[model samples]
Structure formats: structure tokens, C-alpha cells
Target chain A: MFLQQIINGLTVGGVYALIALGYTMVYGILELINFAHGEIYMIGAYLGIIFLGIFTTAGLTQYSLPLSLFLTVVLSVLFCSAYGFTVEKLAYKPLRNAPRLNPLISAIGVSIFLQNYVMLTQGATDKVFPHVLPVTTIEFSGITMTSLQIIIIVVSLLLMAGLHLFIMKTRTGKAMRAVAQDKVMASLLGIDIDRIISVTFIIGSGLAAVAGLMVAMYYGLVNYSIGYIAGIKAFTAAVLGGIGSVPGAMIGGFVLGLIESLGAGYLSSEYKDAYAFIVLILILMVKPTGLLGKSEGHKP
Target chain B: MLKLENIHTSYGHIEAVRGTNLEIRKGEIVSLIGSNGAGKSTTLMTISGILRPVKGKVIFEGREIQGLSPHKIVSMGVSQVPEGRRIFPKLTVRENLEMGAYLKGKGQRAKGKGSGVKGQEARGKGEDTSRGDSRIALAEQLDHIFNLFPVLKERQKQLGGTLSGGEQQMLAIGRALMSGPELLLLDEPSLGLAPIIVIKIFKTIRELNAGGLTILLVEQNAKAALRLAHRGYVIESGRVTREGIGKELLDDPAIKRAYLGE
Candidate 1:
């Protein structure tokens, strides 16, 4: 039973890690908590369903499932990235020079607006994802692992690895780091700050789109309100790890997933959601900078 | 090669650089000396395109460039070593230098335009180089900077924050140089350094000038700045109060009493 819980935790943890990356990366560059990022994830899931439905209508799904899924995933990611880019350009860019509080409030406003837009357009009812992934279960002793769980873990790991390589070895990645440390100094060195920030938003949103599609497939159902709980959970994971650290977010997601799974399994299923916050509080008391964060001095 | 005409800049309601006119001929070391809040740094910021002047024009290489962005100004071969030596603390010294050369990387291959530099192949020219050649050019640039300040080469792997103040200042200057700028604007390069280190930095400035780099140095150390500069401007209350030859300004009684601490 414990091993079974571990497998379930790993599946959920992978999804959380993917979502948490968006939060951590945006925070790293702008130092602003992108409250609207959750809405982007929700929209990704909806876009996936909408595209799948379109393919089904066109008789494409009947011909080749893999080709249909590929188209769905690509279109969903592109549209979500567009939303992310537009949000930053419209809501955040103008307030780049404003007081920190102003952008925070703007983010919150954007979040509400996106949530309502999705709800009104897609309707308040829950939408069912077309069950297309092969359903197979492998049993070892008393523990059983599903094929879907394996796919989620493998895809998430691959995306994370690609992101790591892009950041560590690419020129644009180094420019992003430079802008994060010091904006004015980066500009003096001929780095375009606006373009870098836009790139950050686009990448974060793309990652979130993948997570959204995976979660939709895992559960076979998604709603406009799903982003609220998932976003909060992923954000907790990001803060628990280190708000601005990428690796921290990945580790935090897995740890939080395990804690929630065990809490639901052993303690009380009624309080599974509460486990993440309890650990967050305990960790904050011990290390205010989060698990992997370093204290940074303000620029003079 | 650079001129500022009636530049009036302000922060909120308070004007900092009010009607300041300055000119630097090609291949000259021009120093602007002033007391605290006398607009020396503000003038540099205005020229670098970090701040937009409410009135006046900043002409660089015979082209009006007052309203261009900071990065655009940098790509046009003008760079600033800002006050406080804002080195990225988290990046390694080498990475910080790479950031300085941000323009000469990926985009240069596609654009084939470097900076507005002329007459120096090893200094600022970055055109007509292929991918493999550009990589070699980058390494050669690093070597040139290392040759200029041997200490930076030794600390290349260290984080910028780990370096001492003098070393940080050198890193800042070296980072700016990686862009291969024709016109370099320096702000308070000698601030909060030991006398020996200050002398070394000033000597390096002289070396750079002799090699054909135009320098606009802003300094509080009036005596050293004036002595090194071919011409000097003393600014007071956001205006040029005195302008003359370097030695002539050093000999002026009023200049000595007001700034040289005679």
C-alpha cells in the first residue's frame, strides 16, 4: 500500500513540478507573483479539449490517435503561450516602473479576469476529456502502476531536462540571468530587457500548458475552476522549495505530493489539501528563505 | 566625437543637469569634475540614454541620439561604467564579461553589424566574422581584457561579489570593454579605493586613451582627473562653471580653492 501511494505521489508530483516551474521562473525574472498564471494553465486544458473535439469532428482521431494528440498538444501550447505573452504585454509591461504593489494588484486583477473569461466562455459545467490514452496496469506484488502514470513521469522529466539544458548552455539564458541580477547594468551591456521578459513569459506558459494537458489526461475531466486549486498547490510547492529557484520548485513539487499522498493514505483523507500548508509553515519557521533560496541584498 | 547641448534633466520636480553643454573631440580624455549632486553622474546617465533629457540634444558621431534606448546607445559604440560598479554578484567574473559582450554574440552572426567603432581591428570591429571565427574573436577579446588587467584573468572563475572593491571596479570596466566601445563613459572610478589602487586605475585609463579610445571620465578626485585629462570642465549647480586646458585649470586659483582643496 505504501509503494502504491509512492507511485501515485510521483504521478501527481510530476504535474506539480511542471506547473511550479512557471511560477518560479516568472518570479525569478520579474520578482512578481504572476497570479494569472493559474488561469493560463486552466485555459491550456480547455484548449486541449476544444482542439481534441475539433479533431474528432474532422474524423482525424479515427485515423491516427498519435497524430491527433500531437496536433492537440501543439495547438494548446501555442495558444497558451500567446495568452501568456499578451498578459505580460498588456498588464505587466506598463507597470514595470510602477510601485511593486501596483503590479501585484494588477496580477490579481488579471487572474480574476481570466478566470471569469474562461468560465463564461466554456460554461461553468465540468468538461470531460476524451479518453484516448491506452489503459494498461502492471502489477508487482500488491502494488499496481498504470501506463498513464509512467507516461506522465517520463514526459515531465524530459521537459525539465530540456529546460535545464536551455538555461545552462544558451546565450539567451545567460542574458536572462544578467537581467534578473541587475536591469540597468544589463541594458548598459546591450541586452534588451523587454524581449527577455517576454521570452520568460512565453516559456513559463508553454510549460504550464503541458502540465494542464497531462492533468486533463490523468483525471479524464477538467473544469474552469480546476486551475484555482492546482495553481495554489503548485505555488505552495514553489515557495516551499525556493520561490525563485528552478531546481527547488521541482524538488518541492515531489516532496509536497508525497506529503499529501501519505497524509491522505494514513492520517485523514479529509485534510489532504491542508498538508502542503502545514509543511510550508513549519519550513518557513526554520528557513525564511525557503529550502534552496539564498538571501539577496537590495541593489543601491 | 560626442557633444551635449543644453541638456536639462530632472528627477521628479528637481532638475539635476540644467542647461549643461559639453563636447569631447575624437581621441581626447575629457573629465567632468564636480561636487556631490552637481550633475556629473546625471550628465553621464543622460548621454548613455539611461535618462531622457527634457531639453537639448546628445549627438554621437555626428548623429542625434538623445531619445534612443540604453541598449541601442550601447550598440552604437557608447557604453557606460555606471556609478557604484554594478557587477552582477551572482554571475562569475567571466559570465559578467560575457554579458558585456551580449550584442556581439548570436545576433552578430545574423546581423553582421558590430558597434560604431572605426580604425581599430582588434578593439571594436566585429563584422565579417563567421561562427567559428566569432568564437575565436570572443576568446581573443577576453585575452585582450586579461592582458589589460591580469588580475581579472586570475579571478575569471570567481563570482563577481567575491572580488574586492578594486577588483570589482576592474571587472566593471572590463565588462564594458567587451562590447568594444569607441566611446567609454566612466563614473567615479576612484571612489572608495586605496590610493595605490586609484593610481593603478588612472594609469590604466591613460593607457587606454593612448590606444585611441575616447574617454569621458567623471570623478570627484578633481586633481587626478584634471591632471590626466587633456581638457577639463568644472560643473557647479548643473552648469559648466569653468572650462580650460588640464594644466591651466590645475593652475587656476579659484579652481584650486573650490575643488583642489588648496
Candidate 2:
């Protein structure tokens, strides 16, 4: 039974990690909590459904499941990248030098704009995702795990490893780190500050889109309003992990997921969502910068 | 060659540099000497395109470049070692130097990129020695910098924040040189350093110029700056109070009283 809870928690945690990465990367660079990022994830789920629906309509899903899923992931990732890129250029770029509150307000405004935009277009009802992924379970002793859970865990780990390598080894990644540290100095060294920012948004949004699609597939439903609650939870995960630390975000997501799942099973099932925040508050009270965050005392 | 005409810059409502004109020729170390907040640093910033002047022109190699961005100005062969050593503290010494060679890496396979960007193309005649000749080229450049400052080679794996102030300043200047800039702007390179370190930095500055680099140096240490520069300008209250050969300014009685502290 404990192992069952672990499996369930890991599936949910993987999705949160994907979304948390977006928050962590953007916050790492801009130091702004991108409230609209949740909406991008929401839109990603919608794109996934739309693309899958298109594949179904064209009879492609009937012939090849792998091809349909491939098309869906690629098209959804590309569209979400565009959305994320545009959000930064239109909403965040103009207010880059403005007072800190201005961008925060802008991000909230973008979040609301996106939520309503999706609601008006997709209607206010929950959309169904085809239950195409097999519900077949693998039994090891008393613990049974779904195929979907294994897929989500594997994919999330792969993406996380890829992101880790890109940041550590690539020249562009080093520039991103440099820009995050000191923008004026980076510019003086001939790094294009704006382009780096745009690329960051693109990568972050693409990751969030994959999470959204996976969650939609696992839950078998997606609503325009799902982003609001999921965003808050993922943000809690990011904060718990040490806001700007990527590995911290991943670990935080898993820990939060376990806490919520175990709390729901052993404690009150009604407070499943509240379990994450309660734990986050407790952890933050002890370590103000979260688990892995270093104090940015030198920031001006 | 570079020239600044009637450059007026302000931080908020307070003007930092007002109607300041200065010029530098190739292979010369021209120093701008002034007390704190007298616009010596401001003039260097305006030239490096960090601060856009409200009024006037920044002519670089016969082209007007007043409104260009800092990165664009850098790609055009002008780079600045900033007032404070703003090295990326979390990055290792090697990574910090790698960032210094960022412009050279950009120019390698993408000469077509800057063409559509208007006047801010890679017009610098400076060498892009760090481009994709594998790690060998970058290693050679790194060796040259390490030869000049051997201590850096010993601490290549150390974080930038762990370095001493003098070491940090050396890293800053070495990073700027990694870009292979034609015109280097040093802003208060001698600020708050020990006399010995200052002498060492000044010696390195002379060595760089002797090897055919042009420099516009801003310094509060008027005595050391004027001694090292070929020409010098004294900016008082955002305007040029005096300008002449370095030795002539060093010998002036008024300069000796106000700045040289003799």
C-alpha cells in the first residue's frame, strides 16, 4: 500500500516538476514570478487535445498510435513555445526596466487574459481526453503500477537530464547564467541580453507544455480553469525547492507530491491540495531561501 | 579612432556628464582624470554605449554610434572594464573568461546575422581568435592571459567571489582582453587597490598599449593615470577643464594642487 502511494505520488510529482522548471528558469533570470506561466501550461493541454482531435478526425490515430502521439507532442510543444516567446516580448519586454511591481502586475494581467481567452474559445466545460493510453497494470508482489505512471516518470527524467546538460555544457547556457548574475557586465561582453531572455522563455514554456499534455492524458480531462490551481501548486513546489534552483524544483515537486498523496491516504482526503502548502510553509519557516537557494546578498 | 561630442548624460534628473568632448587615436592610452562623480566614468560609459547621451554624437571609426546598444558597441571592437569588478561570482574563473570571449564566438559562423541589423554589424577589424578552431584556439588565448597573470591559472577552478579584490580586478581586465577588442575602456581600474597592485596593473596597461592596443582610461588616481597615458583630459563638473599631453598635465601647477596632491 505504501508503494502504491509512492507510484501515484511520483506520477503527479513528475508533472509538477515540468511546470516548476518553467517558474524556476524564468525566475532565475528575470527574478519575476511568472504568474502567466500556468496559463501557458493550460494552453498546452488544450493544444494537445486539439491536435489529438485533428489526428482522430483525419483517421491517423486509427492506423498508428505512435505517429499520432509524435505529431501531437511536436505541434503542441511548438505552439506553446510561440505563446511563451510572445508573452515575454509583448508583456515583459516593455516593462523590463520599470519598477518591479509593474512586471508582477503585468504577469498577473497576462494570466487573466490567457484564462479568459481559453474559456471564451473552448467553452467553460471540461474537455475529454481520449483514454488511448492503456490502463494495463504491472503487478510486482502487492504493488501494481500503471503504464502511464512509468511513461511520465521516464519522460520527465529525460527532459530534466537534457536541461541539466544544456545549462552546464553549452556556450549559450553559460551566457544565460552570466546574464542572470550581472546583466550590465554580460552586455558589455557582447552577449545579446534580449535574445537570451527570449530563448529562456521558449525552453521553459516547451517543458511546461509537455507536462500539461501528460497530465491531461493521465487524468483523462482538462479544463481552462485547471491552470489556476495547478499553477499555485507548482509555484508552491518551486518555492519549496528554492525558487531559482532547477534540481531543487524537481526534488520539491516529488516531496510535495508524496506529502499530499500520503496525507490524503492516511490523514484527511479532503485537504489533499492543502497538504502541499502546509508543508511548504513549515519548510520555509525553517529555511527562508528554501532547500538549495543561496542568499543573493549581492543583488542590487 | 573614437570621438565624443557634446555628450550629456544623466542618472534620473541629475546630470553626470554634460557637453563632454574627447578624442583618442590608435595605439594611444588616453586618460580621463577627475575626482569622484566628475563624469570620468560617465564618459567611458557613453563611449561603450552603456549610457545613451541625450544630446551629441559618438563617432567610432568615422561612423555615428551614439544610440547603439552596449553589446553592439562591444561587437564593433569597443569594450569596457566596468568601475566595479562585476564578475559573475557564482561562475568559476574559467567560465568568467569564457564569457569574455562571447563576441568572438558569435562572429564565427554568423557573419550574415549582423547584416540586416543596420549599422551595428561586426565592423571591428579586431581578431576573433576564439572562434571554432576547436579548443586549441581558445586554449592559446587563455594561456596568453594566464602568462600575464599567472595566479589566475592556479585558481582557474575557484569561484570569482572567492578571489581577492586585486585578483578580481585582474580577472575583469583579462576577460575584456579575451574579446580581442581594438579600443579598450578601463573605468577606475585602480580604485581601492594596494599601491603595489596598482603599479602592476599600470605596468600591464602599458604593456598592452606597447603591443598596439588603443585605450581610453578613466581614473581617480590622477598621478598614476597621467604618468601612464600619452594624453590626458581633466573633466571638472562634466566638462573638460584641461586637455594636453600626459606629461604637460602632470606638470601643471593647478592640476598638481587639485588632483596630483603634490
Candidate 3:
């Protein structure tokens, strides 16, 4: 039973990490909390459902589950990346040099705008995500494993590993880190600051899109208003991990997911959401920089 | 290779570079010597396209480049090693140098054609063996940089912030050179260094100038700067007060008294 709960927590936490990465990366680069990040994920979920609906109406899902799923993920990722890029260009780029508070407020405004835009277009009601993924079961001894949970965990881990490798072993990745450290210096080295920032948004949003699709597959529903609370939860995860550290954000999400799951199971389901905020406050009080916070004391 | 004609750059209302004009001929080393607030660094900033001249024209290779972005200017073979040695502190020595050859790595940053947008294609650096020529050229530049600062090569794995001040300065200059710049703008290369290390840096600059690199050096260390350059300009209150050949300015009694502290 305990192991089953851990698997459940990890499945949910993996999704949280995906969404949290978008927030953490933007914050790492620009020091903006990117309140609109949650909306981007929300939009990703909508895009996923819309694509799935298209596949269903076209009678494609009946032919091949793998083909339908592939198309849905590809279309959703591409559209979400574009949306993330446009958002940065229109909403955030103009305020690059403005005082810190101005951009933070602008980010909040963007979040609200995206939320309402979706609510108006998609309607306020929860949209059903068809149970496309097969519900096969793998059992060992007394424990049973759902194929969907396995798929979610495996896919999220793969994406995270890919992101880590890209960041550590690529030229553009090095340039992005250089920009994050010193924008002026990066530009002086012939790095296009604007282009790098756009790429950062794209990568973050792409990850969020995958998370959105996974959640839709898992929960089988998505609403426009889903972004607000999830955004807050993912943000808490980012803050819990360390706002600017990539690995920190990943770790934070997993840890937060476990805590929330365990808390609900052991304590009270009513206060499950409260646990994230409580942990966030405790982390802020104990280690304000978050777990694995980028150490300023360490030279370079 | 570079000319600034009647340039005026400002910070909001207060002008930092007031009606300053400067020039650096091809393969010649020029120094702009001034005290703090004399606009030497500001002049370099304007030339590097970090700041646009509110008035007057900046021509590099006979093209107006005053309002172009810094990265654009760099690709035009104009690179600046800014004040305080602004090396990315969190990156490793090798990573820092790799960032230096950023334009060289892609060969499109200089042409303003490459972008970080299609970054999904930025696959692993392992496949970089495809661009054999550029890769070899980058290796040669790395050898050159390593030759210039053996300490950097020795501590290639060390974090940039962990390096001593003098080592950081060398890394800064080495990083700038990786771009294969035609006109290198150096701001305060000798700031806050041991006098002995300052001499070594100046000697390296002299050697670089001799090997056919045009340099516009900004310095508060007036004595060392004027000593290395072929020609020198003196600025005070954002205006060029005097311009002369290097030795002539060094020997000038007033300059000796005011700057060299003779």
C-alpha cells in the first residue's frame, strides 16, 4: 500500500515538475516569476483536448492509438511553443528594462488575460478528455500497476533527462546560461539576448505542454480555471526546489508531490492543498533560497 | 577601422559622453585615458553599441553602426572586453571560452542569421564534427588563447568566480579574442590588479597590437595605457582635452603632473 502511494505521488509529481520547470527557467533567466506560465500550461491542456477531439472526429483514434497520440503530442507541443514565444514577445519583452515590480504586475495581468481568454473561448465548464490510453494492469504479488502511470512516469523522466542533457551539453545551452549570468556580457560575446530569451520560453512552454497532456490523460478532464490552482501548486514546487536552479525545480516538484499525496492519505484529504503552502512557508522560513538554491557563496 | 564623429551619449538627462570624438586606424593601438567620470568607458560603450550616441555618427568600416545592437556590432568584428572583467562567473573556464567563440561556433551570429529560436535543432555538441573546418579554426583559437594565458589552460575546469582577479582579466581578454575581432575595445584592463600583473597584461596588449590587431583601450591607469599605445587621447568632463602620439603625451609635463603623478 505504501509503495502504491509512492508510485501515485511520483506520477502526479512528475507532472508538477514539468509545469514547474517553465516557471523556474524563466525566473532563472529573467528573474521574473512568470505568473503567465500556469496559463500556458492550461492552454497546453486545452490544445491537447482540442487535438484529441480532432483525431476522434476524424476517426483516427479508431485506427491506431500510437499514431493518434503522436499527432496530439506533436501538435500540442508545437502550438504551445509558439504561444509561449508570442507571449514573451508581446507581454514581457517590452518591460525588460522596467523596474522589477512593473514586470511582476505585467506577468499577473498576462495570467488573468490568458485565463479569461480561455474561459470565454472554451467555456467555463470542464472539458472531458477521452480515455484514449489503454488501462492495462501489471500486477506483482499484491500490488497492481496501471500502464498509464508507468507511461506518465517514463515520459516525464525522459523529457527531464533530455532537458538536462540539452542544458549541459550544447552550445545554445551554454549561451543561455551565460545570458542568465550576465545579459550584457552575453550580448558582448555575440549572443543574441532576445533570441536566447525566446528560446528559453519555448523550451519551458514545450515541457509544460507535455505535462498538460499527461495530466489530461491521467485525470481525463481539463477546465480553463484549472490553471490558477495548478499554477500556484507548480510555483510552490519551483520555490520549494530553488527558483533559479534547474535540478532544484525538478527535485522540488517530486518532493512536493510526495508530500501532498502522503499528507492526504495519512492526514486529511480536505487539507491536501494546504500542505503545499505549508511546506512552501516552512522552506521559505528555514532556507529561503529553496532546496538546492544556487549558492552565491560558491565562487562562480 | 573605427571612427566616432562628435558623439554624445547620456544617462537620462546627464550626459556621460559629451561631444567626444575618437578614431582607431587599422592595426594601430589607441588608448583613451581619463579619470573617473571622464567618459572613457562611456566612449567605449558607445563604440561597442551598448549605448547609442544621441548625436553624431559612429562609422566602423565606413558603415554607420551607432544604433546597432551589441551582438550585431560584435559580429561586425567589433568586440568589447567591458569594465570590471564581466566574465560569466557561474560558468567553468572552458564553458566561458566556448561562449567566447559563440559566433564562430555557428558562423551565422556574425551575419545575424542564426537564432536561438530553432534551438530544438541545437542537438548535442558531439555532432559538431560535421563542421570540421570551423571546429579546427576554433581549436586553433583555443590554442592561441591557451598560449596567451597558460594559467587559464591549467585551471580550465575551475569556476570563473573562483579565479584570482588577474586570472579573470586574462580570461576576459581571451574570451574576447575568441570572436576573432578586428577592432577590440578594452575598458579598464588594468583595474585593481597587482602592478606586476598589470605589466604582463600591458605587455600582452603590446604584443597583440604588434601582431596586427587594432585596439581601442580605455584606462584610468594613464601611465601604463599611454606607454603601450601608438597614439593616445585624454578626456575630462566627457570631452577630448588632448590627442597626441603615445610617447609625446607620456613626456608632456602637464600630463605627467596630472595623470602620471610625477
Give me the TM-scores for chain A across all models, comma-separated.
0.97, 0.98, 0.97
lDDT of 3 by residue, A1-300 (tens): 677778888988999999999998899889899999888898999999999889988999998988998999999999999999999999899999899898899889999999999999999999999877779999886677888899989998999999999998899898888988988889889899999999999999999999988888888999998888889999999999999889988998999999988888888879989999999889888988898886565322
Please give the range of 10 consecutive residues that has the lowest summed lDDT in model 2 chain A. Answer: A291-300
Q: In model 1, how large is the Cα lDDT of residue B136?
A: 73
For model 1, the local distance difference test gives 0.88
DockQ of each: 0.83, 0.78, 0.74
Expressed as tens digits, the lDDT of each residue in A109-163 for candidate 1 is 9999998998889999999998766889999899999898999989989998998
Each prediction's TM-score against the native?
0.95, 0.95, 0.94
For residues A51-115, write the lDDT of model 2, one tens digit per residue: 99999889898889899999999999999999999999999999998999999999999999999
Clashing pairs in 1: none
Query: Which pairs clash (backbone N, Cα, C closer than 3 Å) in model 3?
Result: none
lDDT of 2 by residue, B137-207 (tens): 46756877887789999999999989999999999998988776778899999888999999999999987
TM-score of 2: 0.95
Candidate 2: deviation at residue A145, Å?
1.0
Question: Judged by lDDT, which candidate is best?
Answer: 1
Categorize the docking of model 2: medium
The residue pairs in collision within model 2 are none
The window of 10 residues in a row where model 2 chain B has the poorest summed lDDT is: B112-121
